[model samples]
Target: MDSSSPDETAPAADQTDRLILEVARTELGLGANGGADGDLVVLDDATGALTRAALDALEGTQHRVVVQETSVQHALALAEEHRGALGEGRLLIAGLEDAPADLATLLAGRSVHLALARLPKALAALEVRASSLARAGVPALIAGGRVKHMTRSQNEVLAEVYDEVHATRGLGKSRALVARTARDDLRELPPRSSEVEIAVRGMRTAVTLSGIGSVFGGASADAGSLLLLDALDQAISAGEIEDTTRSDGADGESDGAPEEARAATPGEGSPAVLSARSVIDLGSGNGLLAAYLRSALPAARLLATDDDLDAVASTRATLESLAADAATSDGAVGTEESVGVDAGGRPGEARVLWEASLAGQAADSADLVLLNPPFHDGAAIDATLVQGLLDAVARVLRPGGQLWFVHNSHLRYRHELESRIGSVQQRARDRRFTVLQATRS
Candidate 1:
């Protein structure tokens, strides 16, 4: 019901993708004749196109297949494909908004065929399916297309976790990797993943951040964040931003820090600005932005939120590591009141949700929000995800609050920026990216 990201550039594929899909589909009880009764197939990162063939092959009267995908658009499209089945409850299509939870609840004590796409993402999906369905004595049929999505080494990494892992006959350019999972193995296998270090600096000194549980193109020091960082640092140094520690009617110290952080009453023509006391990193992927924001505005409260649990975990780890480093390195640690750790051992509060929007955050009084809205919603390119993020900004940002945003240069979010919040201005731009600032009027 909310929005999502990107245009998945459809690769020129041979019979490989279709053949692999067919193998996975059939393996999941989508027989040449019809699917078995009470069979549900979970297609992680599924597009509409992939589920269509399986639906077509199913005998409407004899078989039932409940197909689930992660994207709303994909789910709607699949629903249309089997309108009759949907009407009869013989076939069901829905979005995996809550992901593994939704699928797990649906798959309880049921045989499942999980068609996974996209390499590392599939691993996360596999973890969910295997753990949830293992105890029911249900056989899982997992088929992966696009061998390039995962390397043989990556395949082997997962094989160690499952009872048995195997490969299907190579189909043109695509090959299927299937792993049989057991309840015991599923409960015991530790996650296999890698880590990366990211360094982001604006006008201020560089801050090195760490990221674990790779997701979202794998974490790195994003150039877009750096672009916004430049603007943010400029805002901080030049006294253009409101003081993070000041309060209404309370006099502020007027020396050393930027003039904006100084105590002052708004002039008649000047904007009635609010000091940023609460900040949320909407769509805080990898938590790098949150970490940088925490460093840049030490007085403000920071909250990093993401839809992916991995991203939240990664972000929390990065922030904790950064905080730990700061505490020991001849530095003043941020006030524990403003920078407390979360349940996951994340240094600052990190909340995970199923959507990009920051609804019900900050008690509806967030003073600042930063976002790099994802363009890819699942496997395909979509812009509505950005819109959803913007909506969150409008809903959570108090009047006179600000939104710092970065996007692909061609995304051309200026118009939407103006429409959503007044006084949109370009802060920075490069060949591939653009950074903008909008204040909620």
Candidate 2:
């Protein structure tokens, strides 16, 4: 268990004294590793002289569980399988290299008393998850293995989320910090909204947001904004939103007609008819496309899925309202006049609402998959997340099923899609975005 030897180069006496003083005074749960004893678990893959000594000191403890970090996907699978068995007695230790999504899923159902790591990515995820759990009244603890000069705003945010935050004395060339949380009755507060102006086609469009997180600043900025811009341009190019003067005689033809009668008769020179057994809106922001799909494919099943719980709830409300309005329409409609489709192709029923992550979907589930997949993790562009999404698409989409995804024109997803699933062809392209329609062979 002792990976470092005592005969190794010892630090100067002054430095050693400083280290001892720092560990004793500043570090939480420091000193001898005997206080928590069997109650604490240590997980570390990166070996070092001090960390190895710490692990060696806890050897005889019955509660100590050490799991070395490995491949993220494999580690996540193991964590899920062993989570129930460990209960709250175990602490899942992960390095900074672990996947954020995997870590989020693991921490969702479990009581992670403390997570110790030096990875910046892991630290950010831990902060976000801890904040979310705190807002939910669930006490969660996240400890950082390194600390440096941080801005006042950063420290304030951390203090707001964690019950206790402590910065360790700078050790050698590095520093460490610990954040702890205890159960409390923290009231849930509504998320603040902001308006971000994005430049699209030489024009700035404003986007409203309830929370500024990965969905807005990361993936949505790269995928959603570009996709919306492209879709708008395509609508213009296809004449779906064109402005044209109609004759007075044509206007008279539908002046007094019922809504159903108007829908039944296709307008002159309508866009090309698009048909499918079902349409799924992946990452359906505000469920706008879902609403349109519900109207266009009255007979076709429509399913909307998103990772955001709030979006799902909002969509449910929107769909229900749409159904009520459709039911009250002035047309001479029977029981078959419902707008949304059922889960299994039963007509005139509400669309099935389900929550799922792109990395954890079943196979051959949808006829059409529509997505504006996230392309970045925070400010850093990540192609792996996009690849994971495409992999999920490959699993969920039936053979010959199509994937209609919108992304910025700069991102090169065509190669990743082709490599993972099959061929990818650009269905539509514009100055701001590109729409890809891929099919599984």
| TM-score against native, each model | 0.58, 0.50
What CA RMSD would you report for each candidate?
Answer: 9.4, 12.1
Model 2 residue 157 CA deviation (Å) reads 1.3
CA shift of 436, model 2, Å: 2.2
Q: Rate the local accuracy (lDDT) of all candidates.
A: 0.56, 0.45
**What would the per-residue lDDT of candidate 1 be over residues 21-115, giving only the tens digit for each residue?**
66655565455444444454645434544444445545554444555444334454455545555676556553332223244455555554444
| Per-residue alpha-carbon lDDT of candidate 2 for residues 1-441, written as tens digits (9 for 90 to 100) | 122233243322233233433453344353354533332222222322223333334444444333423233333433444453234433343421232222234344433223333323333333454465465333323333433334334445567666776655556644444455743645433333444444433345454333312223321233453455455445434533211112113222324643223212346666322224445777654444455445444444566765543344344444554565566442111121111223353332335332344443346655566787666776798867776667777887766566777877887788877776677777777776788877666
**Candidate 1 residue spans exceeding 4 A from truth:** 1-143, 146-154, 160-163, 169-176, 181-214, 242-273, 327-354, 361-364, 377-384
Question: How far does residue 385 in candidate 1 sit from its true spot (Å)?
Answer: 3.9
Give the worst 10-residue stretch by lDDT in candidate 1.
336-345
